[model samples]
Each structure stands twice: as C-alpha cells, then as structure tokens.
Target: MDRIILHCDLNAFYASVECLYRPDVAHLPVAVGGDEQMRHGIVLAKNEKAKAFGIATGEPLWKAREKCPGLVILPPHSRRYLHFSQLARNIYQRYTNRIEPFGIDEAWLDITEKGMDMAAGRHVADDIRGAVQRELGVTVSVGVSFNKVFAKLGSDFKKPNGTTVIARPDVSRLVWPLPGERLLFVGRSAKNVLHKVGLFTIRDIAHASPRVLKGCLGKAGENLWRYANGLDDSPVAMVDETDPIKGLGNSITTARNLTRQEEIRFVFAHLAQSVSKRLRKQGLVGSTLQIYVRFSDLSHLEHQGQLPAPTQLEDDLTREAWRLFQGVRVQKPIRALGIRLTQLQSVEEAAQLSLLWNEKKRQQTAQLEQCLDQIHRRFGPESVRKAPGLDENLVSLVRSTGVASLPGRPHAF
Candidate 1:
C-alpha cells in the first residue's frame, strides 16, 4: 500500500472562531489582530470574505483597512483559539496516533496504517471537517496525499470547508506547474537560488540534479529538492515530552523607536517571562542567554552571557535580560529587542543545584513558575503576565510581530 498523509487546516481559524460567537458577521470581510491605533498592527488571520478583497496575512492593518474600509477588525483571542485547537486535536487523535500539530490551526495525520485508499482518506477528512463545524461551529480544509509536502499543498488547493485528494499517480500533474514559493521551505533566498539555476517551479527543481541542488542549498537544499519530487520520508512522531528543545527565544518590535530606559526594561521583563513559559512547557533549561537589539537605523547589537546554572526561572532570566539591556549603549532609538536561551539541556537530565542556598532558590523558583503556569493555563496567558508589561500598545506590537508557523502534517510512505 502506498503511504498516505493528511494535512488538516482550520479555515481562517481566528476569523472562523470569531464567527462562531458573532454569526451575523460571518459574511463580512473580517480580520483578527490588534486595534488600528496600534500603528504596527498587521493582519494575523482573515476570513474568506476578506481574502477575496486581496487582504493577506501579515499585511499592514492600515493598508488593509484602506483597501476594504468596511472591514470588520477583531482583536486576537489567543486563548480561545488555542482551546479550539486542542478540541480539533482531540478529534484527530481518534483516527491515528501519528498526528503532528503544525500550529494552533493546522496538523498532519498519517492514516496509511488504516489500509484505506485515497477515497477513504478523503471521507475521513470530510468527516473531521463536519465534526468541527457541527461541534465547534468552525470550518476546516483537509488535503490528502502521500507525503507532508504534497498534503499541505493539497489542503490549500481548496479554501474554507474544502478538501482535495492527490493520488500517488496524479502527484506530478498537480504539483509541477505550481510556483516555487508554494513548495515547503522555499523561502525568498531559496527561490532566488533556484531561479538562478533556471529551476523556477517544483517540476524544474525536482528534475534538477540532487547533487547540484545540495551543493547550492546544502542539507536544506537537498531536502527541498527531494520534497519537490514527492519523496518525503519523515514520520509524524508523537510529540514526546522528553524531546530536546530546538531553540528558546522571544522578540518584540516596538511600536515606534523607544528611547526610555524604563520602557526598555519593561519590554525585557515581558520577553523573559514569555521565554520562561515556553521553556517550562517543553521541560527544558538553558545555560546561555542572549539579548539582541535592533536600532532605528537597522544596525543591531547582540550580547550573550552564560548563566551560573541552567534555568527556566522567569525571575533569573528577566533580571539577566534587563542587565544585558542596560549594558548596551543606546545611541539610537531601539526598533526591536529580543531574548534567546540556547545551550539547552533537558530538565530531567540537568544536574541538581549544588549549594544549599542555591538549591533553596531553585526550588522556590520552580514552585513559583509551576503555580504561575497553572494559573495561566486555567485563566489565560495574560492573566499572570508582569504588571509593567501590560502596556497595551507595546503588548499589541509584540503580539502583532510574533511568527506563526503552520503545524507540520504527518507523512505517508
């Protein structure tokens, strides 16, 4: 039997979720993100009605509003969206354990082991979409194929509440003529490189020599070349609690160039807390903390410091991040700031605290974070955030700039 992968994506997730509560606005052009006064606000997600008007994700809200003056803008409800995502995942788990959540709105499920053919898989996808619509009042799109890359592409072939199946025999016909950008991992740089070699489409890249592509893109290039040919072999590993973290980082692009010392410190504290929450979520700790600042002129500054002990403590990380920020000379207004934790080690494998005082502090910090996590989990992320970081303008800016990568779908053989 050929491997079968299914990519399921919520249709205009945030917008759809909002429509569940405000059904009257279902037919209107809607966008989800920050308020317009927050000049840095960008479209996070848009409903089908809005997409029809040329509104795209990451497009500046100001421009989007101008294009569709009647656009109904809604504030982001991350907690609400996450709740729907969990519900979607619960439903997916019923079909297969080989499920990989790409993000809050997308996931991949491998159903090859069920011995179902493409038609059966399409039925399953349609059923899942129906379940979400009936139960959660949201629409979803499912793409059925033999690999993650193709499955993802298939899902996008249809829009809100649509499904497309790409059989193994028909894969090339469907994928070849598509633009290079439509292929996974083909960013601007990769696209340019591919173009330079006269390989501007998936078909061109797939037919190019793997050795030549590898020489150009290194390992990543090689992977893309393979992906274009519909040859992905990656499995949808169950999300393991013990997996080592790939990276820990937080960034905020200020609404405007910031010059105040207090404001900078406040941003650092917020970023530290955000990073710590992610660390705890993954059961990981880090030994190195790095801080970055992008000045108004686009010049950047970065500082790194080794922690005396690996930690996932919000206080420790925040204090260190603030100190690093203070150490830098602000010759110009700061456009952006970021904090990252690297040199990761699993919390379970990390050594215990040495000194009695140090041990006591570590225990206390851990307990505090656990409590905070519980509260945030039950209430909302904003429920327990640092008081100083509650500057609405700044918070909106940070939320607007955050990257949202769609979850990876399961790969079929």
Candidate 2:
C-alpha cells in the first residue's frame, strides 16, 4: 500500500479564533497583532476579508492599516486560541494516534492504515473539518497525499475550509509548474539564486542536472532536487517527551529603545516568568543561563554563567538572568533583549538536591513556587505574575504579543 500523510491546517487561525467570540467581526477585514505603536511589527493573522484588500501576513501593520484603514485590529488572545487548539488535537486523536502537531495551527497525521482508500482519507479529512467547525466554530483545510511535503502543499491548494488530494500520478501535473518559492524549504535567498539560474518553476529544477544543482546548493541543493521530482520520504514522527527542545529562550524587541533601569527590570521580570513557565511545562531544569543584548547598531553581546544548581525555580532563574544582564555593558541603545536556559535535565528525574541551604528555607521556597505555579495554572499566568511584571506598559506589550499562553491551536500562515 502507498504510504499516506494528511496535513491539516486551520485557516486564518488567530482571526478565526477571534471570530468565534466576536461573530460580529466575521467576514470583515480583521487582523490580529500588536499595537500600532510598534511600527515595524506586521499583521500576525488576517481574515479573508483583509486578504481581499491585498493585505498579507508579515507586512507591516501600519501598511495594512493604510491599505484598509477600516481594518479591525484586535489584540491576539493567545490563551483563547490555545484552548481551541487543544480541542482540535483532541478531535485528531479520535482518528489516529500517529499524529504530529506542526505548530499552533497545523499537524500531520499518518492515516494510511485507517484510511484504506483515497475516498476514506477524504472522509476522514471532512470529518475533521466538521468536528472543528462544530466544536469550535472554526474552519480548517486539509491536504491528503503520500508524503509530508505534498500533504502540506495539498492543504494550501484551497483556503478558508477546503480539501485537496495529491495522488502520485498527479504530482508533476499539480506541483511542477508552481513557482520555485512554492516549494518547501526555498527561502528568499534560495529563490533569488534559482531565479537567476532561470529555474523559475519546480519543473525547471526537476529537469536540471543533479551535478549542477548540487554544485549550486550543496546539501540543500540535493534535497531540493529530490523535492522537485516529488520524491520526499520523510515520515511523520510523533513528538517525543525526551526529544531535546530545539531551544529554550525568551526575547522581546521593544516598541522603543529603553534606557531606564526600572523599564529594563520590568522586561526582565516578564522574560523570567515566561522562561520559568516553559521550563515547568517541559518538566526540565537548566544548568546554564545566557543573556543576550542587541544594541541599536544591531551588534550583539552575550553573557553566560553556570547556575549553582539545575533549577526550574523562577526566582533562581531570574536572579541568574539579571546577574548576567548586569555584567553586559550597555553602551548603545538596546533594540532587543533575550534570556536562554540550556543544559537541560528532567526536573522530576534529577537526583541532585541543594545541600547548602537549611532544610526549612529550602522547603519554604519550594512550597512558595508550587503555590505560584498552581495559581498560574488555575487562574492564568497574570493571576500570579510578579509585581514588576504588572507595569501597565509592560502588561499591554506582553498581552499584545500573545506569548503568555501555552502552545494550543495549530495556526496557518
């Protein structure tokens, strides 16, 4: 039997989720993003109504506003979106256990066994779409194919709640004439090179000499050569608990370059809260904490230090992050700030315990952290946020960025 993969993508996910609560905004030129004050930021998501006005994701929000002044700008509700995402995943589990969430808005499911025929696969996809629409009142697009890349492309064939199938024989007919940029893994720079080589379409690359393509792209060139020919064999592997996280960090590009110590401290506290929440969620502790500072000139400086112990405790992580920040010289306007925790170990499995502190103090600190985590989980992150994080400006900025919530819904671009 030919292997089958189904790529499911939620349409205009953030905007769709927003529409659930505010149906009045449906079919309007709505966008979800940060405040207009952040001049360089772009539309995070847009409804079909906004797309009709030539607005696109990642285009500056100011430009989008200009393109359609009446565009409804809604602050991204990360928590609510996440809640919807969980509902989508739960529905997916009913179909197959071989599921891999791509991000907040997309996932790949191996239903080759469950879906014995193309028609069955389509039925499964339709069922998923109906489930989302019924349970969450959002629409989804599904792409059914024999591999990950084609499955993803199939999902994009239609929009705002649609489905497309890519059988093996139709691969060339469906994909080859598409622009080189449409191929997976081809970024802006690669597209330029391909363009210059007169390889404007996937068909052009498919017919090009392997030696020439490899010479041009190195290892990536080889992969592209295979992709152009519809020869992808990558499997949809379920995300494993033990898989080392790609990265553990927090970063914020401020609305304006900040110089005040209080403002910087406030940002630091926010970052700390975010980082600690991630650590607890992953059930991991870190041994090294790194701080990154990007000056106005774009030059960057980094400071790192070994923590006394591998800790998931917010207070300990924050103290170390602040210590590193203090050591870095701030000679120029700061454009961005970041904090990272590395050298990870499962917190539940770690054998090492603090010995320097007296038993009572250690117990008290642990109890305090446990209480805080409970409050955060039960009410919300803000329900138990540190006082420093409550600064009005800081709260507005964080809420706008939508980073406070856990990864829930699969969002589509």
Candidate 3:
C-alpha cells in the first residue's frame, strides 16, 4: 500500500502571528521586518493584503513602503511564533508520532501507519487546516500525497489556506505542467541553467534525457528527474528521531556596503569564527565550505568548494571561505557576506590526514581554538579576538549581528 504523507505550511506565518497579537493592524497590509536602524530592515514576512501591493518577503522595507505606502511594518516576535509553532505541533502529535519539521512553519507527517488511504489523507489535511484555523487563529495550507517530495509540492500548490491531494493518477495531470523550480531543490541559479536547455516545466524535466539533465544540473538534475517522475521515496522521520545537523552557517548584513577586501575579510573571519565554534560544540566537522554574497543591489550569488580536509577550526574555515570568495569576480559591493560548512561528519569519525600539508600545525591550531573556546565560555564571547581585531566598525557590526545564522532561509530537504 502507498504510504500517506502530508505537508503542512502555516500561511504567512510571522505576519499572521503578528496580526493575531496586534489587532490594530490586523485589517491593514502588514509585514514583519528587521530593525531598520541596524540595516537589516528587509520584509521578513507579510500578510495576504500586503501580497496584493506586490510587497515581497526579503525585499527592502523602503521598497515595500514604496509599493504599499500604507504598509504597516512590525518587528518580529520570535517567542510568539515559537509558542504557536509548538501548539500546532501538539495538534500533529494527536494525529501521528511520525512528524518531521521542515522548518518552524512547515512540517511533514507520515500517516500511513494510521491505516489512512489517499482519500482519508485529504480528510485529515482538511481537519488539520480547520483545527489550526479555529484553535491558533492562523491558517494552514496542506498538501497530501504518497511521499515527502510530492507532499511538499502539493502543500505549495495552494496558499493562505487550502488542501491539495496528489495521488498516483493525478501526477500526469496536476504535477507535470508546473515549473521545474517547483519540483524542489531547484533554486533561481539552477532554474536559469535548466531554462537554458529548454527544460522549462516539470514535464520537460521528466521527459529530458537523464544524461542531458545531469550534464546541466549535475546530481541535482538527476534528483529533479526522479521527483518529476514521482520517483521520490524518501521516508518522513519519526517523532523521536532527532534531526541531525546537516550544515552550519552564519551571515551578516553590513550597515554599509563592503568594498574593501580587508573589511570583507573581517566579516568572513567573524562569521567563520561563529560557525566553527558551533561545529565544535556540536562535535561535527565539514569537508565543504560555501560562501554567500549579497551585493548592494540585492543581487546575490553563492560558491562552495571542498576543503583540504574535514575541519572544525576557525582558522581553517576562515582561510577556506576566503579562498572561495576570492575566486568570485566582484561586480558589486557586498551588502551581506556569509559562511557555511556542509557535507558534515561527526567529529567522532576519524579525520583524513595528509603528508601534503603540515598536520602538526593543524593540531596546534585546533588546540589554540579549544583554548579560546574555554576562555570565551568562562569570560564572554568577546573575551578573545579571532582575526587580530580589524576595524572597530566591522567589530561592532559583527557584534550587533550576534549569533547570526541565515534568518528565514529554509534547508531544502
């Protein structure tokens, strides 16, 4: 029997939650934004009304204001979002213990064990949507399907509040005509590449030669082909199964566009420092390091490369991230810079060593980082400097964006 899966996504989550608490702005077009004074003032989330004004999430607040002059911008309230997220999770627990959270506002539920057939799954999706609406005062869009990938695609089929069911018979009719990007794991960058080859829709992706797709998209192209053909059979995680940390990253939006190499390095150093510390704390190391750059124009690009070896040392991370950034041809001043460590392995695993590099130097550096972590733990995070203190403006900028991770960036599962 085909397993039943449902992807539940909260509608305009942050903005909806804000409206619930701030009734004064409930009827107006509202958006949840960051601190303008801090220069992180981007539309983090917006309600349906704001959507009508062409106010998009991740666009600048000034631009959003230009689009909708009467737009009400409210600061984010994370605590409330979390409280409501947990409450919604509680509702899911009543249905099944096999719940896997895609993000705070999205989750996947495996209801096959409940003996639910495809028809029953749609009923449950409606029940979940209605229950969340009545109890939490927020709407949910749900996609019910046989597997995780299609379930996520189905949930995204409708918005604000709707339930979409995609069963085997519906694949050719409903799923194929959608854009290739809608098939999942296809970002803007990847979409352009596929488009270049005339693979515009999910049907095109499915019908295209696998070799041709892989030649264009590499491993991701192959995955897209499988997803387009309804070949995704990945299981939803059980509730008791803790999600493993797949990657670690940190980023900062500067108060000013960073043009100087020295200033950019300072930002990279701080971000890498935070990420490496977190990796060490979690007892993990990564072999791949990725750097993300958002230019002053809001245009962005990301590049990544394999490291010399798996590492959790700040110096190693900073050096590798800087190496990757240097290869990018700078067309514009940087508005934001980020570092990410992926292809991670637990520190408990034996690290590969090479005589090609000085292993002893790396050991010394790791020891030094551990000592610094001890000092930072006892005194404070500011007790030690990572990269021989650069500009004070950059120093405070990093401090202001303390514990910076990619805000609202979801992992493509």
Candidate 3 Cα deviation (angstroms), residue 301: 2.2
Q: CA lDDT of 321 in candidate 2?
A: 79
Q: What's the ranking of the predictions by TM-score, best on top?
A: 3, 1, 2
Q: Is candidate 2 or candidate 3 better by lDDT?
A: 3
All candidates: CA RMSD in angstroms? 6.2, 6.2, 2.9
- Candidates' lDDT values, in order? 0.80, 0.78, 0.86
Error of model 1, residue 339, in angstroms = 2.9
- Superposition error at 373 for model 3 (Å): 3.7
Judged by TM-score, which candidate is best? 3
Candidate 1: where is the Cα deviation over 4 Å? 239-248, 259-266, 273-284, 288-336, 346-348, 352-413
| Per-residue accuracy of model 2 over 1-413 as CA lDDT, tens digit each | 77778899999999989987888878689998866676335588999999999998867687898999999988787788778888888898898877888878899998888438777788899899999889888899999988887888999999978989888888779988799888887877678888887889989999998787887888888888888887888877764434456347777767777677676766667777778877877877788887777676556777889988677677777788788888877888786677777778886556455422344765587678778879988997778666766677766544554333322222111
lDDT, residue 114, candidate 3: 55
Q: Look at candidate 1 and tell me the lDDT of residue 210.
A: 89
Q: Each prediction's TM-score against the native?
A: 0.75, 0.70, 0.89
Q: What is the lDDT of residue 318 in candidate 2?
A: 74
Candidate 1 vs 2: which has more lDDT: 1
Checking candidate 3 for backbone clashes, the offending pairs are none
